[model samples]
Target: MTQQGARWTADQVLALAPDPASRKAGSKLGTAGPWSETGSADEGTVWGLCKGSGSKPYQTVVDLADAAGPAYKCSCPSRKFPCKHALGLLLVWAGGESSLATVPEERAPEWAAQWLAGRRKRTADKAEQRAGQEARSAADPEAARRRAERRAERISAGAAELEQRLSDLLRGGLAAAEQAGYGLWEETAARMVDAQAPGLAARVRELGAIPSSGPGWPARLLEECALLHLLDQGWLRHERL
Candidate 1:
C-alpha cells in the first residue's frame, strides 16, 4: 500500500493508473499533462489543478498528512481508480514542476479557491485548539485516558461487527447477492454506514453492479468479495491504521 506523505513519483503515479489508452485520452483532453504550480509540505497536503477537456480543468488534491488515503475527483466520465487524470497530475507534481509559475495573485475562479483559504485558516486554528486541549488533558490524565479507552472500545466493537458480517456474507454465498440486486447491497451498505464504515459501504454498493456487468460476472463477483473480505480483515486487525 502507498504510504502517507510518501512523496509521489512520476513512475509511481503512472503505475497506479489503469492503462495507457485512458492516460493518453485524458492528456488529449488536457486533464493531466503538466502543472502550473504545486505546493506541499512534509506534514501538509499537496494541491494542484490540471486543464481538463470540459469547460473547466479538473482539480487534483492529495492530503498526505492523513493516512486516510488519496482522493481524486475528476470531471471526466471514467470510473477507474486513480483515474488517468489524477495519475498524470501527480506525475507532473512529483517530477518537481513547482517552479514553473509563481503563485497567482488574483484569486482563481471561485470554484478553484473555494476551499483553499478557508482550509488553511481552519488548519491553523485547529492546531492551536488541539494544543490547548492537549495541555488541559495532560493536567487531568485520568479523564483523557477514559475518553481514549471509550473511543477504542467503540472502534473495536464496530470492527468486530463488520468482521462477523463479512463472514456471514461469505458463508451465505455471494451468488445470492446478485439475485437480490441493488436492494441487498443498499441494505448491507446501510449497515456499514451504521457501523461507521462508509468506505466499505461504498465498496459494497459497487458490488451490486457486477451481476449485470455482462461477461465474467461470476469472476467479478468473486474478486469483489475477496476485496471486501480483505478490507474487513484489515480494519479488524488494524483499526488505527
Candidate 2:
C-alpha cells in the first residue's frame, strides 16, 4: 500500500500478528464469509466490518502509511495491539482485487473516514514539527559545526583504538582470538561505546558472532577482521579521503 497500489503479501500481513494464536484466529476470518463493507483506499487504508458473536459487527481499520508500521484499530474487545479483526482485514486487503474492493474517499463509511482523516492530520503535524526542528538547527550553523567536530573527534579516537586492538589480536594469532571468544569482542565494543562510536561498537559486537557461525568460521572471521581493519584505517585517515 505504501509503494503505489502494490498489495501486501499474506506472510507480511501474518508477520504483524502478536502471537501464533492471533495468526491462527486471524487467518480463519481472512475470507469474505465473516466480513462485509470491506474496502481499501489507494492512500493505504483498509477497513471492514467483521461479524462477531455480538449482534453488531466489529469495525476494523488498518493504516498502512503509518510511520510506525501498519497501525490498527478495531472495535473488538481484544487487548492485542492488532486485534484479530484488524489482522483479518489486512489479510483480505493483501489478497488484492479478488478479495477486497477499493472504495473512494468520499464513498468510505463515516467511521472509517473520520479515523483516516485524524491519522493523516496527525502524520502531517509530526512532519511539520520535524521540519521546524530541522530549520531551527540549521539556523545555528556554528553550533552544528561544533557538534559535528566533537562527534568526529570521538569517532577518530575510537578508530585508532580499534586499529591497535586488531593489530594485537592478529599478532597473538587468530586461534587465540577464537579461544578468547565473545568476551574479548564485547569488552572492545564497550570501549567503542564509551567513545560514542555506535558504528564501531556495532561492528565489534557482530565480530562476537563469528565463532558460533558454524564451519569455516575462522576464514569468515579473518575476512571480516580485514574489512574492519580497513574501515578503522579509513576512519583514521578520513581527512585525506
Candidate 3:
C-alpha cells in the first residue's frame, strides 16, 4: 500500500468484480466455510487456502500495498484480475470472517512472500524514478522560471483583451446583444485560446452563453462581467496577487 493508504470498503471490494455473477459468487464465498489457514499481515497482505471441486485446495493471496488498489493472485482457474477466490478472501477479511487470524508481517507463506518481494521492488523503482524527475527539474530552475514568466505574460495579454471586449459590450448596452450574438464572443475566446490562456477563454465562452440564457439574463451578464473585471485587475496586479 502507498503511505497512509485508506482501507478498502465493502463496496470497493465488490466493485472489483468483473461481472455481477462474479460479484455474487465472491460474496457467497466470503464466509469461512470453504476457506482454511486464512491469515492477514499488518503490512496489508491477505491469504487463504480455498477448497474447490478438485482434490487440492486453491491458494489465494491479496497484496493490498498496491497504490492503485489491492492486487490478487489465485491458483484457481479463473482469469479475472481478482479471481473469485481472491475477492472472497478480501470480502471475508472485510466482514471479519471468523476463520481469519492476524500475524506478524514476516510470517507470510512462501507464495505470498514471493509476491510481496516483487511488489516492494516495483514500488522502489517508482520512487527512484520520481526522485530522478525531481532532481532534473531542480537542475533546470532557470528554464522553468523563464517558461513561467512567458506564460504569465500571455495570460496578462489575454486578460487585457477580454477586459476591452467586456467594456465594449457594456457601452453598447446588453439589449443590443440579442442581435450581436455569440460570434463576437467566440472570436474573442478563440484569440484567448491562441494566447494559451485557457482560464480567460473559458470565462469568455461562459459570457457567450448568457445571451441564450432565457431568464434574468441581464443579472447573469452583469455578474459575469464583474468577474471578468476581477480577472483583469488580478493580472494587472499579478506580482501582488
Candidate 4:
C-alpha cells in the first residue's frame, strides 16, 4: 500500500506481510542489525542484503514506484510473497533506524540494477500491450468488421488459386514433383502470402519442405499434398459443411 509515495508508515509495512508471524519477524529485524549495503535508488526501489541463517546474505527488493500497487522480490527461499526479508526491509527503511536506509550517493549494486531494469522493461511491455488492447476496444465495431471481411475475401481468392495449383500438380502426377524443385512451391507460397492467406501459404511452405524430410519423404509428400488438396476443397465448399 502507498506505493510510489513518501516513506511508508509502520502500519503500512505490517499490512503487506504474508502472515502475522512474518510481520512480527519483520518488526524484530527492522532495526538494520543484520542488514548491510542497504539504500534506496531511483526514489522507487529500496534494496539491501539481509544476513540470515545462511552464510551469504539474502537480497531483498521492494518496488514502491506504482503508488497504486507495490511488489517484492527476495533471493531467500521463503514460499511467502513479500517474505520476512522484504517486509523487514520496508520496516528498516521506513523506520529510518539505520543509516543503511538512506539514499545511496553511488549507483545501485549489480543485483538491484539488473532487477530494476528487468522490472522496467516488463512494465513497458505491459503498458504497450494494454494500449493496443484499449485502442482495439475503442475502434468502431463496423469498421473492424469491414476490415475482417476484406481479409476473408482476400483469403478466399488465395485459396481458390491454391486449388488450381493443387489440381495442376495432381494432373501432372506426383512423380514430377521430385523433379519440379522447391522454386515453384516457393513462388506459390509467396503468392499466397501476398494474398493474405497464411493457411495456404503455410501449406505451400510445407510442400516445399517435404522433399528433404528424410527417408520415405515421397510418401510423406503425397500425404501432405492430399491434405492440402482437401483443405482447398473444404474452403471452396464451406457453406455445405
Tell me how many residue pairs clash in candidate 4: 2
Pairs of colliding residues, candidate 1: 30-51, 52-57
lDDT of 1 by residue, 45-70 (tens): 44555665466656665443332234
Q: Estimate candidate 4's RMSD in Å.
A: 20.4
Q: 1 or 2: which has the higher lDDT?
A: 2
Candidate 3's C-alpha lDDT? 0.76
Instruction: Determine the backbone clash count of candidate 2.
Output: 0
Model 3 pairs whose backbones collide:
1-65
TM-scores for all candidates: the values are 0.44, 0.60, 0.56, 0.53
For model 3, residues 1-241, the per-residue Cα lDDT tens digits are: 2234545556656655655577778888888999998898778888999999999999999987653345778888787666789879888888776668878757878877787888888999989997886677689998668867887888788788888888888999987554555446657777887777767776775676576567788888899989889878987787885
CA RMSD of all predictions: 9.1, 10.2, 14.8, 20.4
Model 4: residue 59 alpha-carbon error in angstroms: 0.7
Candidate 1 has its poorest 10 consecutive residues by lDDT at: 100-109
- Please name the candidate that would achieve the greatest TM-score relative to the true structure: 2
Error of 1 at 4 (Å): 7.6
- Pick out the ten consecutive residues of candidate 4 with the lowest summed lDDT: 97-106
lDDT of 4 by residue, 1-241 (tens): 2333567767656655545577678888788788898888545778889998879999888877742245678998888766888888888888866565445424778888788778788988979997885578568677667767787788788888988988888889776665554446766877887777767876785676565445787788788888988888887788789
